[model samples]
Target: MIMRPPGKSARALLAATLLAPALATAQDAQGQNVTLELNAVEQVDEACRISFLIQNGHDTDIAQAVYEAVLFDTEGRVDRMTLFDFGALPAARPRVRQFVVPGMACTALGRLLINGADTCTGDGVAPDACVRDLTLRSRAEGVEVMG
Candidate 1:
C-alpha cells in the first residue's frame, strides 16, 4: 500500500487542472476543422461603409478581417452576412463583432430583430400556423470581384 501524502497529491491534481485548459486549447488549434466566424457588423448606408472584425471561431482565435466590396457584379449575385447582437449560439456563447469578408454572391442574411432569443418559431401546431418575420438583408453595391 504505497500511499502518497494527501497534500502532495492535491497539489499535483491542482497543477494538472490548471494546465488542462491550455493543453485543450493547443489540441483544438491543431484540429483539422477550419472554422470561420462572423460575430456581428453594422452596415452603414447599405454600401461603402463596413467595419470588419473577424476571428477564427475559436474562443481565443485571432484572424485578419478582409472584405472586398466586389462580389456582386457576377450575374448580379451577392453574398450577405447576418448580425445577431443578442441571443447565444449553439454549444457556445453569442459573440458579436464587425467584419467584412469576400463572400459568395447572391446571399441573403437574416437577422431576427424581435425574436432573436428563441430563434425557433415552427410553432405551427397544425399543418402551418406560426409565422415569423426575419430581416433579410441582401448584399448590395458589391462588384463582380472576389478575393
Candidate 2:
C-alpha cells in the first residue's frame, strides 16, 4: 500500500470536519439552549451597574430567570456576588437587565461566574420548567457559565 501526507486542502477539510461539532457546541451548548451576553459594567458615581442580554431559544416562553453571578478579583479571589432577576424574557426576544452593586466597579473584576439559574419558570398558566436541563457555552475568557 502507498501512503502520502495530507495536503493543505485535505488538512483544512479534516480540521473543519473534526471541529464541526465543537463549533456548534460553542455557538449553542447542549440541553436547553440560550444565549447570555454581557452588555456593559460601568461604575456610576459610587455604585457599579452591570447590564446583560438574555435571549431565549426555546419554543416556550420564559417568564423569569434568576441567576447568581460571582465576581472575582485580580488575585482570583471572590470579590462579590449579585443576583440577576429577570422577568418575561419571551422566546425569540432578547431581554436586557441591569443590576447595581454598591461599592463595586468593573475594574475590580477579573472574572465572572454564572452560578446557574435559580429560577427558570416558563411563561403562561402552568408553565414548563426550564432550569433542570440547561447547558452553557462557557467561553471562560472572563466569565464561566455554570448552567
Candidate 3:
C-alpha cells in the first residue's frame, strides 16, 4: 500500500480530478471495430496436436493479437499444447504455454495456440477434427509491467 502524507490526498485529488467533458473526450474513440478473424486449421499431427490461425482485421498497421482454446468430445482427447500469446507482449519473443489435456501423452493435440503479431497467424493447422476457439486479444499499445 502507498501511504500518503496527511492532507496531501486532498490536494492531489483536487488537482488530479477529471472533468465530465474530459472523460467524454478520452472515451471518444469507443467503437465496435473488428480487430481480427479466425482462419481455418492448417494442420494436425499424430500427437493430435492442432494448429490454427487468425487474420488481422483489415488493417496492416493495427498489430493486434489472437487468443484461442480447444475442446474435445467422447472419443476426443488431448495431452498438452503449448501456446504462444504473441499479443500479450508485442515486443517479447513468442511464449510457449503448455496445457495438459485430459488424456495421455500419446494423443495430445499437435496443434496449440499461436499468437499473432497482427494479420499473421502463421501458415499452420492441425491434422484432425477438434473444437478449438480462435480468439483475439486487441490493444492500442504495449502497456504491461515487467517481472
Candidate 4:
C-alpha cells in the first residue's frame, strides 16, 4: 500500500517539534538571569589563561552561554579579549570555564572585565541578553611582574 501525505495539522506539529530546541534554548526560569564572574588569571609559558565562574541565578538549568572577557594592560589600554562559549552550566552551583589568549602573559594585565554576553539560556536566552545590564566581579589573587 502507498503512504498518504501528511495533513496540515500533522505538518504543523512536525515543524514545531523540529523548532522546539532552538526556541527553548534562550528562555530563563521565571525571568531570572545569569551572570559571569572573573575568578583567576594565570600565565603558562607564553599564554595567559583566564578562568571565570558562570552563575545561573535562575531555578532552571542553563545549556549554553557566550561571553567576552576583556583584559586591560598596565597602561589602561585594552590588551586582549577573548570570547568564551560554554556548555551545560548548571543552576545553583556555579560553573567554571577557562579562556586562553596566546602569546600573552598575566603579568602585564591590570584587570579582566566581563565586557558582554552574547547569549545565555536556561530555556531560551532573550535577544537582549547581550545588552542587559549585569555585574562583573574580579577575584584575582595577585599578579607578579615577569623578568
Total clashing pairs for each candidate: 13, 0, 19, 7
Q: Estimate each model's TM-score.
A: 0.26, 0.64, 0.24, 0.64
Compose the digit string of candidate 3's lDDT tens values, residues 1-147: 999764987877765674656765544432212222222221233222222232322212224333333332224443233333434312212333232333333232232233222222322322110112323442212111110
**Inter-residue clash pairs, candidate 2:** none
| Cα lDDT, all candidates | 0.32, 0.69, 0.30, 0.67
Tell me the lDDT of model 1 at 50.
Answer: 34
RMSD of each: 14.9, 8.7, 15.9, 12.3
lDDT at residue 99 of model 1 (Cα atoms): 37
Q: What global local distance difference test value does model 1 have?
A: 0.32
- Stretches of candidate 4 off by over 4 Å are 1-31, 122-124, 129-133, 142-147
Residue 58 lDDT in candidate 3: 22
TM-score of candidate 1 versus the correct structure, residues matched by position: 0.26
Candidate 4 differs from the real structure by a C-alpha RMSD in angstroms, to one decimal, of 12.3
Residue runs of model 3 more than 4 Å from their true location after superposition: 1-46, 60-64, 74-147
Better of 2 and 3 by lDDT: 2
Give the 10-residue window scoring lowest on summed lDDT in candidate 3.
Answer: 138-147
